[model samples]
Target: MDRQKYTIALLGGTGAEGSGIALRLARAGHRVIIGSRDADKAARACSELAGLAPGAALSHDANPEAAAAAQIVIMTVPHAGQQKTVQEVREQLAGKILVDATVPLVPPKVARVQLPEGGSAVAAVQRLLGDAVRVVSAFQNVSAHHLRDLAHVPDCDVLVCGDDPEARETVVGLAADMGLRAWHAGAIANSAATEALTSLLIAMNMRYKVPGGTGIRITGLEETAEARRT
Candidate 1:
């Protein structure tokens, strides 16, 4: 499959996880707009990423403008701000693939599984955006430390979930572009499992004393991995 380059907007892209994601996307030859609540902050992030991904098409904007201008919008906001951010950019999200990477970790107790009322954070995004938006859940378990390191191909897998099969495939391809294995993990509701796994990974990271943060690899998929390499 030929890879398609997209203009991707990472909302709340000023943060560590968001910036790391933007860097990978920009390096993959996709145009990346780092979106933040403050335009200056987003611009600063873009400048920093430019050095990391030299000659990569990278820019910045306030979240709403970024969301409106991009082919795909990725939500990387903190769980506390997820709802407000989505509501602010709701109109711009229509007819676009909205990838929700929001993990509902309630701070200090982040190691404990604390799923929201709907069970899945991305599902809440889907409900908020309605049918006009193709909301896909991904990147919940990818470590920022791994993504920021250009030489490091994350020893992990991305489980993409969405109500739309095509949208899920698009995200799976995007993950491939980041040099990671990804799979269609079924409907949007299935995202609850992946989202909840973030907390478990956190617990394991602490218990095992792994500095780069622990990640997941789906076992017994050698054939799938081989097919991708062919």
Candidate 2:
């Protein structure tokens, strides 16, 4: 699996989700490129990322450069940075699959689900990028803490929603590579439901004693010849 044809580019890779994914891919023997707004930050993070997977082709580059170098781009930045980030790297993202993991978490009252005026972050990205980029929404339900520890495969499913079937499939494959179970959650608008579920899960976590805990189990499937052998 490490011999995957292309590298995973993580924009805003210094952030929790982005960095966690970078490590996850590295552990899985896949090439990963961490993109940062600051060149110096990328340089520092790249060194640590390389340490995670010895001799792994892991490196850091500026957002645009990383986008250009990778086949798939996962945007792990916050909702606040989505538009500007896309605009800045729009040229590099052309014809690329851009996974949007943004959640509209209005900090002070994030306990409640808040859909933005743009409907959903996935829709917002589609609107902002037009046809230049293929945006897929995913990874909104998992905690960054769990993703970083490659030893623990969280019992969560990644809800991948996007207009482009190829892009969605690419993300699903990438999710599997990262030890995640990804589901095609329909068109980008469906992201509104999945993104909202994040808060519901968080509220449940708060009520319970489970810290940074949330998971989904796909029932009705037993270990068989056709299923993925764990």
Candidate 3:
């Protein structure tokens, strides 16, 4: 993959997660398009991301146009809005990768899992996009708070899953560029498990007041000294 030769579009780019991803991608030298339902909001976000990475070559547009302009589209909209966002840009997403960052957090009692139909956001996107778009799931458990810092983001692991290997690799590249450890967690069906972990993490966060929250690390998966000796 050419480090300086890709264009990424972030749908719902006005939000913290979306804008942060846009900012980091822009800093990485990709042509980034900040997309929103409101054209003005997208424009403002592009300006903000530009400040984060000077001469980042970011642009702004309504959802459809933004998706059309970029080779990859990222759906960072809230769960409630995720389906609609995908539908709105579906026509423009044919043969492109759609990175889904939506978590099903239904207001008030968000600590409880509230998964959508099809079991996960990526599944919902795959359904909506049919075979036209390659849906890849990622960033569900990631904290929006980290992306807000343009200077640096907390060390985090991202589990990227999709049926299409190309799509999964594309998202993994983006994750790596953002200073994250990304693992290919099998197909899009596995996304249901990954998304559920976030709600469980939220409950842990409330109970322990752990500011940064909990992240899963596979024990013994790392080649520790004890394992190496065996």
> Which candidate has the top score in TM-score?
1
Which scores better on TM-score, 2 or 3?
2
lDDT of 2 at 139: 90
For every candidate in turn, the CA RMSD to the true structure comes to 1.3, 2.3, 3.8
Better of 1 and 3 by lDDT: 1
Which parts of model 1 are misplaced by more than 4 Å?
225-230
| Candidate 2 residue-wise lDDT at 199 | 82
Per-residue alpha-carbon lDDT of candidate 2 for residues 1-230, written as tens digits (9 for 90 to 100): 34355687999888878888888777777778999889888877778777766787788888888889988888888877888888888999888888988888888777799888867877988988888788889998888888877677877888789998888877777788788877677999899988888888888888886786876655654464323632
Q: Give the per-residue lDDT digits (tens) of candidate 3, residues 1-230.
A: 35435888889888988888888788777888888878877777778777778888898888899999999888888788877887788789989888988888888878998877678867877876788789999988777777667555555678889999877877878887776667778889889988888899899989999786666654544566422322
Cα lDDT for residue 194, model 2?
Answer: 80
TM-score of each: 0.97, 0.90, 0.89
Candidate 1 per-residue lDDT, tens place, 53-169, comes to: 899999998889999999999988899999999999999998999999999999999999999997888898888778999999999999999989999899989999999999998
lDDT, residue 106, model 2:
81
Ranking by TM-score: 1, 2, 3
Once model 3 is optimally superposed onto the true structure by TM-score, how far is the C-alpha of residue 67 displaced, in angstroms?
A: 0.4
